[model samples]
Target: MPRFAANLSMLYTELDFLDRFAAAARDGFQAVEFLFPYAFAPEELAARLHENQLQQVLFNAPPGDWDAGERGLACLPGREVEFRAGIHQALAFAQALTCSRIHVMAGVVPSNQRPEDCHSTYLENLRYAAAAAAWQGVQIMIEPINERDMPGYFLNRQAQAHALLDEIGSPHVMVQMDLYHLQVSEGDLASKIRRYLAGGRIGHIQVAGVPERHEPDVGELNYRYLFQLLDQLGYPAWIGCEYRPARGQRPHATSEGLGWLQAWL
Candidate 1:
């Protein structure tokens, strides 16, 4: 059976950030991932994970000024120092929580920056971050945001993301294939997943309903078939539920959206 992980970022809006662990555990999630958990101290977050017996599948390095549309800056020039600092901070949390994967958000490109320059900078920064992560037995995954959702973000296509991973040529650096973005940017989601899987390039996965970005059943993607395909492919990693609730209710009601998944599994 495919392992399902709840994205705490999208699942538990009713609880404060610190309380999400208990909420996810009570709701029967065996594993969880969060976009950013740096707001809390590493020791405190570690304690919560132990208390709840939750497995941390993934989390991200802090992106600068998340509110200002600066999702991340790991690739921006003149920001290497800040990027390295962010990696160290993330490592602290990963170590405490026994996290195996960290998604490195490639920041938006500066208006005047050349594409070639930004790409080169991004490669260098990712190489350094990957090396650092390898020391701690963790892999850093790069996520490609869809252009429609993130207008000017760097790394917006799966092909581009794959190219970056190819250039880096580090086992520690791979791609976090979010099916929602792939569906928008590139159709034929299964083929793309197969290609990445064949090349051993995919490091993690996240998914949501297609058009609505809500629970799986609210949109057009056939997750029952998708999960079956993944099972056939022998995908042992956790597939995260990174979607919003359709009725604006708590994610515990996600069972409604995942009804098909329950039966499929």
Candidate 2:
């Protein structure tokens, strides 16, 4: 069976961020993930996870200046220093939380910059991050977000992410495959999963409803079948529930919308 992790960043929006951990555990989720942990102290986040007996499966390295429309710094030419600093900070949190994976977002490509330059910078930065994380026994994850959702995002396809991993040539670095992005950008998801998962480069997996980004069962992709496929392929990793509740942010909306997960469980 595929282990599922609640993405606290998206789910449980009605509760405080710290309170979401207990809510997830109460809902029977054994693990959790989120976008960024930089807003809170590592000790505080760690305490919640310990209290809930929840494993912190994944989280992102800081995306530079989120308020200024900056999504990530990995692919930006002049932000290598900031990107590396963010990696160090992420690893520190990973250690405190006993988390083993960190997602590094490839920022939006600047209109004035060359794609080739961005590609080179992305490779260099990932290699550096992988090296830094390896010492901490943590792996660095690179996700290919869809351009529709994040226009001009540097990475946008599974093959593209795997090829970059090839160039980076570090076992500590791998792709963070999100099915929602895969369905939007490229629809041959089963083939992509088999191809990449078989190749041993997919470090983590995430799921959300297609088109609307709601609970997985609300999507057209048929996650029940995909969940079975994952088991058939022996994918032994956590699948992060990275989606919003279709129930909106009303009280208990996240829990009420967990029929999909409960059915599988």
Q: Which one is best on lDDT?
A: 2
Number of the predicted model whose TM-score against the real structure is largest: 2
What does candidate 2 score in Cα RMSD to the true structure? 0.7
lDDT of 2 by residue, 1-265 (tens): 9899999999999999999999999999999999999999999999999999999999999999999999999999999999999999999999999999999999999999999999999999999999999999999999999999999999999888888888999999989999999999999999889888999988899999999999998968989999999999999999999999999899999999998888656
CA RMSD of all predictions = 1.6, 0.7
- RMSD of candidate 1 to the truth, in angstroms, is 1.6
Candidate 1 local lDDT, residue 125 = 89
User: How big is the positional error of residue 168 in model 1, measured in Å on the Cα after superposition?
Assistant: 1.2
Clashing pairs in 2: none
Off by more than 4 A, model 1? 250-258
Model 1 residue pairs with clashes: 72-107
